[model samples]
Target: MSQADACLRLNGVTNKNITISNNVLYCGSQLSIKATNDLTGASVYNNAVNGSISATGIQSCGTFAISNNVFINATANNFYPAAGSPLINNGANPFYQALYDYNGMSRSLATPTVGAYEYSTTNNSGCATTDNFKCGSSTASVPQYSLIS
Candidate 1:
């Protein structure tokens, strides 16, 4: 899959503010995200893409800022940056960022890391903890796991 086959595809027809940031997309053959027809604004940054990004027909209304992102492969099953990965502490200080990470971990205001995960030496990959997760392949569907008590 190419950029046309992104993990998250956004097709904007109106003047809406679109920001695709703080994401870790392991698209395998596809791209991270594909933004099309953004009439107002399209902000794409602070991401860790295992592939690429594609944008088309972006209008000049609101500012489009894309910066401080890392492009590298993440570990499988629990999509986290590998040891000494570029995605570690290479985040963009976006005008607006998510308050928390993929596992609901509070982001550090002083030191921000690219993608959906915050840098942690002892992170559990959220495979056995937390409610939200970015711990899978972008090409595949969400798998089923039986709850264990």
Candidate 2:
């Protein structure tokens, strides 16, 4: 990762043994994974993103791959994949897969989906958002703030 003020969020970085997995990161189109210090054991896998993954950093013992165009309405704030989405079963074994997604839905351990949310064949309502965020069944906007004098 470049040590510049970019529009990406990567913290607590080290030379080795770092994991960045199971995320739906909207890291623009100029995103990449680089290891300048000959980094090893970097796990970057099972992600549905519009970026690139390079194994140029991992010397050995790590998973690094990228699945492209794996969303139905990513740009529309609906990160859920359609029925025929490649993200359905394109992910490798997650580092530590959670039992549920951001929406608190059960996840498939055998055939894990990429990103924070899993593809739900039972639900076709799509991810509806409000104020650029996803809430249960609905969303909220017009953030309330107070000025402390």
Candidate 3:
């Protein structure tokens, strides 16, 4: 997949809450926003992708959380670079924070960063500030898995 393509795309038109969880999105070349407004709330977790991914536009506006996600550029072409790719810590806007790092560590940024994995500032094994694994206040466990191999 190229950086010009978006495997999963979401655009909000109203000031409402949006939640996305336990989904598998592959080859996404563009941006992915969990929620787009103050009344919005998005959760992304346990999903796997084979290309660059990003989440933005969720700062003080509402709740935008990305957790337990695995994104890799398995393509042989390596169409995008690490720095220029959308997988960077903060590609579009710096409003989205990283609740968990790539190493499964608990962390958060001073400002919201980009990508699915957030660098953990504290410990690797702890509760994430955004809580991407769980959707909203519900305790019901919803598990999903996507295999690319």
Candidate 4:
């Protein structure tokens, strides 16, 4: 059966105080969880999954805080993506881009929008200096601030 890329997935299922950043999840045998059951104060950052994350992306959770995430299970060669694999490092609080939300303070931009939009090193004089507002086929270099000053 070829419809199991996300048979029962849950990423950063949230319980507040959450922050799942720089997203890119491409599961082909999915069963990815990042907080099941009784989730408390949650926080998942720098999230990235290539494929096959059968279990433990923070299931049966607790006070989670998984950081700098980049779990690639490329058919389970194992770089850690199973067995209570909330993707580990669950102590949250380590997602620096100057603590994001720039323009209201806390700045550190320049192509850093992986999971909550943090890409701005100032360059949007109305975008089109070769259109760095990014949107399709690229020679790269077209994304200059939309929300991260």
How many pairs collide in each candidate, listed in order?
0, 0, 14, 10
lDDT digits (tens) for residues 1-149 of candidate 2: 56532223444446466666665545566654433344445666555445554435543323333354556655666667666766676666756766766656677888877666677763435346545457644543322323359
What TM-score number comes out for model 1? 0.60
> Which residue runs of candidate 1 sit more than 4 Å off their true CA positions?
1-4, 38-40, 57-76, 128-149
Worst 10 residues of 3 by lDDT: 72-81
The per-residue C-alpha lDDT of model 1 at residue 96 equals 79
Using all chains and alpha carbons, the TM-scores for the candidates as numbered come to 0.60, 0.62, 0.28, 0.23
Clash pairs (backbone) in predicted model 2: none
lDDT of 3 by residue, 1-149 (tens): 34345656454436334444323344444443332333224433333345444445433422233332322232332212233333334322233333444334443444223444442332223222233332234443323323359
Model 4: worst 10 consecutive residues (lDDT sum): 124-133
* Residue 30 local lDDT, model 3: 44
Q: What residue runs in model 4 are displaced by over 4 Å at the alpha carbon? A: 1-19, 34-37, 45-95, 98-111, 115-149
Q: What ranges in model 2 sit over 4 Å off? A: 1-12, 32-38, 53-56, 59-69, 122-127, 136-149
Instruction: Identify the leading candidate in terms of lDDT.
Output: 2
Best by TM-score: 2
Worst 10 residues of 2 by lDDT: 138-147
Q: Model 1 misses residue 81 by how many Å?
A: 2.0
TM-score of 4: 0.23
TM-score of 3: 0.28
On lDDT, the stronger of 2 and 3 is 2
